[model samples]
Target: MGTAALVTGASSGIGRATACRLAAHGATVALLARQAEALEQVCREIRSAGGDAFVVCADLVDAVGAEQAVAQVIDRAGRLDMLINCAGAAHLSSFADDAPSQWQCMIDTNLSGTLNVSHAALSYLAAAARSDRGTADLVTVGFTAGRQSGPVTSVYAATKQAITAWSEGLRRELAPSGVRVGLIQPGLVDTPLARRLGAGPGQGLNAAVVADAIVYVVTRPAGVAVAELVVRAVGR
Candidate 1:
């Protein structure tokens, strides 16, 4: 009976936080991730808080799997009003030191994975905008590296940059259809992914900070569309 949202990477980090946030706001959330156990744990927390949540285990890097995930959300939730493309991977090493496989993994998970899920969900989002919510949302999680190049995060930056470009194009193209597309570019986030990427204890923003920005983007008044937002920790 409430807005239905599908959040990829809902197993942890920003995705998990966003799913909980949206659910707190009364939306029924569909949690998508490759880790069934983690996704189930998130679902339990949401349920404990009296929020509705369901899990759809998926590997976004697989196009078919991504489509199936989207389909499962539609089948289970009945409709999707928001799509949070938060699934991502990072490899932080100099270009020379990074293995080709590392580069490929970043490309596959961060870039291609986003594309696969977005492509599969566009139509459902559009339909939800037109019929149910009057405005649908597509929110992608980007990184500060995407806006400014950095040494160790070259490939990761490239993927985030691509997301920015793609989100811009989508924002313009979907404007007429009452669907809002936005990107959240965070400077640093304390997550497993960020830690693996070499973020220090004192560095980076909290994942909740980025999740708050995402909630702001998706909960805007129907007449207003927040196209992009950049969040950075103080003094960074």
Candidate 2:
């Protein structure tokens, strides 16, 4: 009965936080993640909080996994009003230290996976956009890694850059169709994924911070499209 949202990577970190945030706002959230146990845990928490949630287990890196995840959400929820492309991996190492395969892995998960889910959700999102109730939306999460070249994250940065650029273009392309597309660029969120970066103690924003930003975007009025949100902790 309420607006519906699909959040990938909902097993943990930013995706889990974003799912909870949307559920708190009365949106029925579809959680997509590879870990069934952990993803179900998030769904349980949302249900316990008097919110609606469904879990669809899939590995986004695989060819058909993203589409399968979205299909399950559409089947259960009946429609998709929002999509959060939060599934991603960070391979942090010196450009020279990592093999080409590592970079490919990052590209497949962050870039190709986003495309897969977005393509599958387009029809439902388009239908929602045409509905009078609200504006349909698409959001992809990126990182500050792309904003700069660092000592050991060149490839990761490149991948994030690709996501940012792709999202921006998609936003413009979809803007006329009543579907709002945007990006959430978080700087060092304290997530399981960020832990892979090897940042020392106290070097990140809480996942809740990014989640709050997501809520702010999707909850806006129909005419209000939040183009992008660049959030970072103070002194980071």
Candidate 3:
């Protein structure tokens, strides 16, 4: 009977941390990811801590999988109060050096997956807004790579830039209906995805930092929407 949150990419990194954090604070969490075993483990941890959690194995890159994941959460949870579109892929290759398939994978998973889950959860979130469930919110993870052009992360940055623009537009459009849209842009987090970036001499941050920012945005009192929060390492 607590609030329900649907988190994509909930098996590891920031997604897993966010799921545990939210559930710890009394939200029923739905964990979505392609790795069934990992997702189950997170759900088990949450449940063991006396929190509510459900696991849904999904590849957010696929449209069908994205829709089905959200649908299943709604079917079981009865409603969805928050959606964390945390599903994405990380690639580190120069534009010219990168294969076309690599670029496509980044786009599909980072940009397309965000849209797919948000679109699927729209109705349920809107309904939560209409009722007394509190302000419905959508939070998407972004990166500083997308804000500036980089030598190696060109396409990855592009996908994140798309997310920033799209989320802003969504924030304005949904504000009137009591649904808030938020974006968390973190600079170089020490996640599996971040390691894939091959930071070389630079050290970013741990994924928990990003998870804390998300908790701040979603847990704030109703009527106050934290539209966007950007966190970066001090040396970065």
Candidate 4:
């Protein structure tokens, strides 16, 4: 079977760059996100570059939708060797300042969304791990905010922190299964999310730079597990 990978939030930013990078490395990539038109555009770009890609448009915040999206990827891609969880939301606000809706948005998208997709893809990833590939990767796109909290981004930071802890536990749990679960903790990237949070050029890493970190994580030889990588801009 050919190597197949699934990437969430592939419509833009780090997710988009990761999907393209994985495809350029010859993995059949399934791009997942809530944006149909945007995902289709990504798919077109991948195909034009002689890479195989397909779009799976589903809201990751909904458990059922996330499961269906994973199923769709397996159905079309034949197998899933890598699952990259990049579907997340970032809302910078004080805990007391946010309305209930805003807090829920961060919790549901950043925290629960990542869980739902990872849970749905676990068995498939494990099965792939047992295949001739002999290894599988389950990656979460985390942030430095997860390691150190910011005052205004209380809720957002909490969500990232949760994912970091969850990824660690998952790494231990899936270790024997030959599934290498890892997290990419980047300091600041020039993603749509970071721009919305006021990150200026030359102040943070580029989205593709983080994507390169992800590619590095997934491409290590078998039995070599990079549990977590901290990517930060120079002199920061």
TM per prediction? 0.97, 0.96, 0.95, 0.97
Q: Judged by lDDT against the true structure, how good is candidate 1?
A: 0.91
* Per-residue lDDT of model 4, residues 50-73, tens digit only: 999999999988999999999999
Lowest-scoring 10 consecutive residues by lDDT in candidate 3? 194-203
Give candidate 4's error at residue 81 in angstroms.
0.2
For residue 33, model 2's alpha carbon misses the true position, in angstroms, by 0.8
Deviating ranges (above 4 Å) for candidate 4 = none
Q: Cα lDDT for residue 12, model 3?
A: 89
Q: Tell me the whole-model lDDT of each prediction, alpha carbons only.
A: 0.91, 0.88, 0.88, 0.92
**Tens digit of per-residue lDDT, candidate 3, span 1-236:** 37999998899888999899999889999999899999999999999999999999888777888889888998899899999988889878888889999999999999998898889888889888888866888999998775786888889999999999999999999998889899998888777776666654336777777888999999888899998888988967
State the weakest 10-residue window (summed lDDT) of model 1: 194-203
- Candidate 1 lDDT over 1-236, as tens digits, reads 38999999999889999899999999999999999999999999999999999999999999999999999999998998999999999888899899999999999999999999999999999999998468999999998888988888788899889888999999999999999999998888888887776778756788888888999999898879999898988888
Which pairs clash in the backbone of model 3? Answer: 190-205
